[model samples]
Target: MRSDPALIGPLLERIAAWRAGHAGLFVLGVCGAQGSGKSTLVATLAERLTQAGVAVAALSLDDLYRTHAERQALAREVHPLLATRGVPGTHDVALGLATIAALERGEAAALPRFDKAADDRVPRGEWPHAPANAQVLLLEGWCLGAKPQDTAALAAPVNDLEAREDPDGVWRVHVNAALEADYQRLFARLDRLLLLAAPGWDVVAGWREQQEAELRQIGGARVMNPAGVARFIQHYERLTRHILSEMPTRADLTVRLGPNREVLELMPGA
Candidate 1:
């Protein structure tokens, strides 16, 4: 997706203005569905902010995913579906909280990186270090600022994956509870939040398919194919729909996008 200067320039101005007024570390949350171009937008925003002489650092919730072995143990203990990442319960949120606290304190912080191809976190030695005094922190992820669904809402399965694998509701309940607790605490640290609103959930699969195609072109390993992409996104269907429905009014800013991933509008939250 191409970054439109018409859109990004104004947004950056707003962010810069907000940063100027904020005292300490200004943490911004960029929330979006899978393949909604959040990572690209955050990277571009960071580059622009840096060029404008703002000390900035960016992190992804993807990077805080639980180690493969940890997830394996969770799967063995909770449910087999816990083995796959993406849900709230699958993240090492304590580590995420610690990292954020460190950044806010202006301490040199080692940022974690997850290797999706290896389905594991990169070794600590390889983790990147953030500058001690990053003035702005951008945390981007699919589930950032997502709220827990009420237990009644979780009664019905959203898709085949849940209907079949989570028939007993054990896994979904576990995920929702995590969102209510640790995830809420983690998100409470954001000074401002933005939602990259997708036109609809129906377009997510197609966009993700495009991403997988690009991954394949780069010889990326462990990339999902078309069918795999379909099933994999099922893991996120419930919360993706939740954020699409709920986050517009909840985020500090919302960037509405069309299926082509082009920016259509920028809106301030309630």
Candidate 2:
């Protein structure tokens, strides 16, 4: 909760280390479970780097969500299981790849924005020329580099949720099937992947509940609630745990966070 810039010294050091070595499209991924403070860290890092005279571009993978209408339509026809997101297949991976590639190539484009409470995207304008050779691009998301778990690996309860949305639809199976390829495409562009580590899915449940409460106060009753929060957590359970395990073996850096989402320690990836 402390806003002291001094607390983030080590993370800044790690990023600076990366910048000292290369100049090619530096993709910095801020990975965490839902509400684990990944977005806050990305925003802070981007601001600090920009203040330091480093060109920075901040993007969220959440914004890559399929529009509400599109998701609703998919939920009704092809698979209602497709309605809730957080899984890899629910996103526009190819579009994400294209946008990052374009940005790296110095092309101008508008960034996408999504409202979690509304579960929809709002239109926006093009991000200007990336301050010339932008030194950093911060990508924050729940499962930025998460690999899909096999349908068999999912808990028995998740199978029920998947079935509820799309009876006779093999949504989970199809979703896991695409994991390897999408992450491959996403990781290929990464200069470094930084994970904001949580103790367990409990971190997700707790922070998500807090977020919903705050939203109710700010955005009113239309915002998410305990039931909706639980439903949203259901979408990520399988891969969420998998990523928590996988990132320690895969990421370049991991910042362990407490229940309050405060940085507890620095965990270097194997």
Candidate 3:
């Protein structure tokens, strides 16, 4: 249960190595399962880098979620599942691409932020601009470098949410298609992808429920109880499993986590 005191040190080393040869704007992805502390890792890294006089831009994939109105319209037009904000199809990938482009070009890019309590993006003017030429840009998300499942893989429902709600596979297919297209393009911009892999999906579920509990303690809005957490998590279960199995082999670095979020294994990807 004890955290690895040296976790950040080695990561900074690896990032320095990546930056050594990169031409400009080293985009490092801090990808992890839900409630697995991707944001904490990025924040810690940004602080460490800043202390050492490095410029960094910190962002989150959750920030790219489409507006609540946009998602509601999608739900009416596409499938009812499109109304949820966590899935791939719910994000505005074009905005993500454009923002990253502006940062890479040494132009001020307003980093987006989503108000999870309200389940919507905060106004654009409220977004703070990241100065140009940041030495490192950290974009963390649950699915930062994830890929779509095979079409054949989608034929079977992975959980009750898929079986009972999306029996025809339409909703899941739409998510995968988005992942294959725009998500991939956005992911391609990452100079390095660091995966924070949980022990398994069960652990991820526990982590998410714990998150909900903490949020509720603070009277956070739209907070779900454990049962609701279970149902809501099913929306992400399929791809969560896919990334846990697939990303370790390909991520620039993979940090396996214990049940308590302690670092268990750190493998440099092939």
Count of clashing residue pairs in every prediction: 0, 0, 0
lDDT of every predicted structure (CA atoms): 0.91, 0.74, 0.90
Model 3 Cα lDDT, one tens digit per residue, 113-231: 99987889999999998866777899999989998888999999989999999999999999999999999999999989999999999999999999999999998888998899999
Clashing pairs in 3: none
TM accuracy, model 3: 0.97
Report the Cα RMSD per candidate.
Answer: 1.1, 2.6, 1.5
- For 1-270, candidate 2 gives per-residue lDDT tens digits of 235453467788888888787866688888888888777778888887888888788888888888788888867875667787667667777767877877787655456677766777765553334455556788888888776666556434444455476354466666676677776688668878888788888778787788889988887756777888777677777677788887777788887777777777777877
- Give the alpha carbon lDDT tens digit for every residue of 1-270 in model 1: 447885688888889777776888999999999899889889999888888887888899999999999999999999899999999999999999999889989987999999998999999999988878989899999999988988899999999999999998999999999999999999999999999999988998788889899998998888888889989989989999989998899788999999888888999878
What order do you get sorting by lDDT, best first? 1, 3, 2
Superposed Cα deviation of residue 109, candidate 2 (Å): 3.4
Ranking by TM-score: 1, 3, 2
TM-score of every candidate: 0.97, 0.88, 0.97
Question: Which segments of candidate 2 are over 4 A away from where they belong?
Answer: 1-7, 124-130, 158-169
